[model samples]
Target: MVKLDGISSFVAIAEAGSISAAARRLHLSKSVVSERLAELEQHLGAPLFHRTTRKLSLTEDGSAFLERANRIVWEVQDAVAEVAERRGSLSGPMRLSAPVTFGRMHLGPALYPFLARHPGISLTLELDDRRIDAAAEGYDAVIRHGTVEDSRLVALPLAPSRRLLVAAPDYLARHGRPDSLAALRQHRAIYYTNRNVADWRFADVRQDVFVRPPAALRVNNGDMMRDAALAGLGLALLPSFIVGEELRAGKLVRLDIGHEAAQELIYVAHPEGRRASHKLRTLVSTLREHFGTPPYWDVV
Candidate 1:
């Protein structure tokens, strides 16, 4: 019979991408983890990973093994959680990924009360603007803005947010407000370099669209874009969630360009067709409840 312990160790190593890291996480010695992995390979009669001095990469067989291993591990964990819940408690670590500013400003605040409500649940939240592969990264779920592109993932719409073109009061006073998209060419623009730095998509309708003019100051960080706009560096296109207070306080003015700069649809997404974990489902449902009546950005 395949030993569940050895299989669990192998899965840990595969997910961690390094034996040492897996060992650290599992609180097991590196040698023990390595030995179990070797035993697992022997039982399967195939190499699962490409071991190197720096990193371990899954072989094709390992990748296939990982998919099943993830399910098995979750299933075992679910059984434990089921028993725990019967005792009226939910307990586990949840890994979540989200965009930097939005997570910090909007989602983080909403999650605080939820976390407080569930003392048994621990969270590892990674804040980043870069698109992440949740499955590869082993995230329980990701809080995302913008339309879903990958059909492989299951997406639940958590909220509606919009991207708006705006300029600081000072900037608009100096450079003058852009009357149309064509006038954007005459103004200096602060850009999020990591995002669509050169070409910004805007539309009057779903079918009618065009790209905006290029930017002069290209930055990678969304917060930096907000800072630059606040400092009167240039006009910026930002999600309303990040600049809602600024706009409300009259620090920034929404540009009346008479077009929607594409919608930013917020979603809680995870791997498709996977059995929903109790903790993950609870968290997602909580968010859906918080965002059900359209986010504060819409009203503000």
Candidate 2:
């Protein structure tokens, strides 16, 4: 019979991305974890992960095994919980992924209180701008900011990620405020390097508004882009989550050509057709509650 401990170690390593990290999560020594993984791989007759000095990634077979592994782990945990007379407190490790800025500014702070409420739940959060393969990476949930086309996952919309075209007061003073698309092009731009900077779209009411300014600065981080814009660098088309305070305060001015920019729906996604554990369900519920309707970020 396959050992459950080995499977648990495998899942931990996949999620944590390193032997040492996984060992820390399992509260086991590195050698013991390594032995468990070696035994598990030997039984399966294939290498589950590709290991380098600095990083570890799943092999193709490992990717296929991960989803089933998750199901097995959660099912066993649920079975025990049922036998335990449905204990009042829920406890398990939840792995989550999100964009850096959103996680730092919103998700992390909001979820910490949930952790306090349920002291038994353990959370490992990965914050990156790059899109992740949640199942392959062993994350219980992933927060995404745009269209989630992967049919393998169930996506629950969190909120409307509304955007705005804004510039610093000094920048507007020097370059003159743009009242229309043509005038908007006259100013330079601060670009977000990850997405397509050239093809910007707006809402229906703001159809007359368009921008393709020459890029003066390019950065992948929202915080850096916001800081650059605040330094009187150039106009920036930024999400309200990142610049909402600046727009509300006197730090920045929104160039309302006609209406707001296009709003992409943000979503929380997890593997489809799988039963979520009580711990995962709690996190999802907490997130939905925290980011509903107008969304907390847009409040101020």
Question: How do the residues 185-290 of candidate 1 rate in per-residue lDDT, one tens digit apiece?
Answer: 7888777765543336676543234445556578767788888899998888888888888988999888977777876689889877666678888888888787
**Residue 72 alpha-carbon offset, candidate 1, angstroms:** 1.3
Q: Determine the backbone clash count of candidate 2.
A: 0
Model 1: residues with Cα > 4 Å off, grouped in runs: 24-29, 59-64, 197-199, 205-211
lDDT by residue for model 2 over 1-300, one digit each (tens)?
Answer: 679999999988988888898898778999999999999999999999998888988999999998898778878877764543377777766778899998889887778899999887778888999878877666777888866778989887878887788899999889899887677678898888777644367666343444478888988888998999999999888888999888889798888776566668778888776666677776777888887778877754
Whole-model Cα lDDT per candidate? 0.81, 0.82
Instruction: Report the C-alpha displacement of residue 73, candidate 1, in angstroms.
Output: 1.4
TM-score for candidate 2: 0.81
Which pairs of residues collide in candidate 1?
193-219
